[model samples]
Target: MKKHNFSAGPSILPQEVFEKSAQAILDFNGSGLSILEISHRSKDFVAVMDEARALVLELMGLTGKGYHAIFLGGGASLEFARVPYNLLKEGGKAAYLDTGTWAAAAIKEAKFFGQTEVIASSKADNYSYIPKGYTIPADADYFHYTSNNTIFGTQMQQFPDTDVPLVCDMSSDIFSRQLDFSKFGIIYAGAQKNMGPAGATLLVIKEELLGKTGRAIPSMLDYKQHIDKESMYNTPPVFAVYTSYLTLQWLKNNGGIAAAEAKNNAKAELLYNEIDRNPLFVGTAKTEDRSKMNVCFLLKDEAHTEQFDKLWKAAGISGLPGHRSVGGYRASIYNAMPIESVQVLVDAMQELEKSIQ
Candidate 1:
């Protein structure tokens, strides 16, 4: 039976992407060698890296003028340190918009490299909304924002335009939307959520923005270093890159970023509408700031929480449990999930309502 999976990360991918990738794993491009066996320097692997980078550029509407698309290791956690290290010079500061756990973590990492000014934070309301009306320091190296808060289910509906380079952690919603790439200087995201599986990060940086801090950053941490080496100085994550390639190709063939954004909005609408209509449920995030990718809601009667979960699990719906820190369910509708899968969850909610508590 095809089960509905709503886990936040390492979430659902297009079935076609998985099947094609599985075939390639057995015999990559008819080389008579499993994809796992190929060396990173091989011509076949180089093509995969190039295509993955190209697809990212194409989908994000980057015309290769200023942006350098790169696939790097160490995920967004590593970028937390690297972002400030590469940008913040001696006596310079970077502004961070603290929304939730990941944004708070980014601030913690940025502090190690240089001063990080917390210009705006949503902590007053337990991170239920995105902060607003804070002054960005004019002398700061860059302004950092987390585009989507996966844990808290809030998102920045609109970004503030500034002269300083705009840095963003788009981990949960990179290819799922459309935006003007020129407005962003650096954008990084861990691939597990929307791009593909984990083990790698995709960074789109403005080429001109590098070498400004004037510090000898370690080779790996430096964006310029990866750009110069073509993301192949060391053996890259072969399978992850290939899977990302498949996912990007799938995105391109299936109406690109614009279509994905529409589908994502629809999914969020379907779930949120049900949450509002049902008196027994309450949404966690505010309406204007709720994330299209992660929809968090709670049952009004806490007594029925366990019963609500048990019913869904028995019906082949899994991973609807909310994060421990936040009680309730989080339905993470990423790029690969179809509207039909969302309908199943909505239908399950209706069925649960029809049945006795």
Candidate 2:
């Protein structure tokens, strides 16, 4: 039986990527050494690093003139602090959109490093809708936001135009859809969810955005330092980067971002329509702000949670449980998740609803 995975991060990776990557580990391109055993400083591994970084730029539609793509450690949590440390300067205020857990955490980290303000939020509707129509301060250093709220299931469908730099934490929805990269000064996403594996994070930053901060930064904490070193100042996660390389290759060969976007749209629509059409299930996020990646829903009778959990498990499905904060179910359909898996969940819901009725 093929078990379907709906767990959010450290989530699904393409079967093809895994197959090629496993072979590479044994003997990479006739090098006769395990990918993990090779030195990251070697020329063989350097090509992998180079291609992985390059593919990110190509995937995002960058022309290769304005931005630098980097793979770094520490997940997106490090970026929460690193973003403000690099972009937020003295006497320079930054604007943030507070949507849910990740956004709130990013805001808190930024406050300790510099002057920060919350320009918009969805706390009023209990975070079901995206906040709108707020003016970004002209003096702001940069405006920061999370593209998709994984736990809450709300995505910023369209970004607000701002004059200052726009930075996004795209940890949950990276590569799941096509985005306008020119609109953002900096974009970062942890790779565990849609890209490849854990222990790696991707960052794309415009060249002009760095070096404005007057404060001194530690060698490792500085974005410019990593960029200057070409993400090689220290040894990188070799195995993770190799797997990501295979995944990017798979993406390129199987139709790049456009193909992924269409498939993601179809999968999300199938489940969201099911949620809306069913009387027993209720969607947490509002209509306009629903996420194309994470589809969260709950049963009408919260008391039947135990029985519902058993039914899904017996069906050989897993990871449909929601974050404790959301208190229901979240089916994270990332890049590698087959639409068939979604159809299975949809069928399960129909069966569960009928049985309950």
Best by lDDT: 2
Cα deviation in Å at residue 169, candidate 2?
0.4
Residue range 140-259, candidate 2, lDDT tens digits: 999999999999899988887878999999999988788788899999988889888898888999989898888898989999999999989798878888888888888888899899
Total clashing pairs in model 2: 0
Query: What are the lDDT figures for the candidates, one per model?
Result: 0.88, 0.89
Superposition error at 230 for model 2 (Å)? 0.9
Q: Model 1, 192-241: lDDT tens per residue?
A: 99978889888999988888886888887888889988888777888888
Clashes of 1: 0
- Runs in model 2 with CA error above 4 Å? none
In terms of lDDT, model 2 sits at 0.89
Prediction RMSDs, each to the true structure: 1.1, 1.2
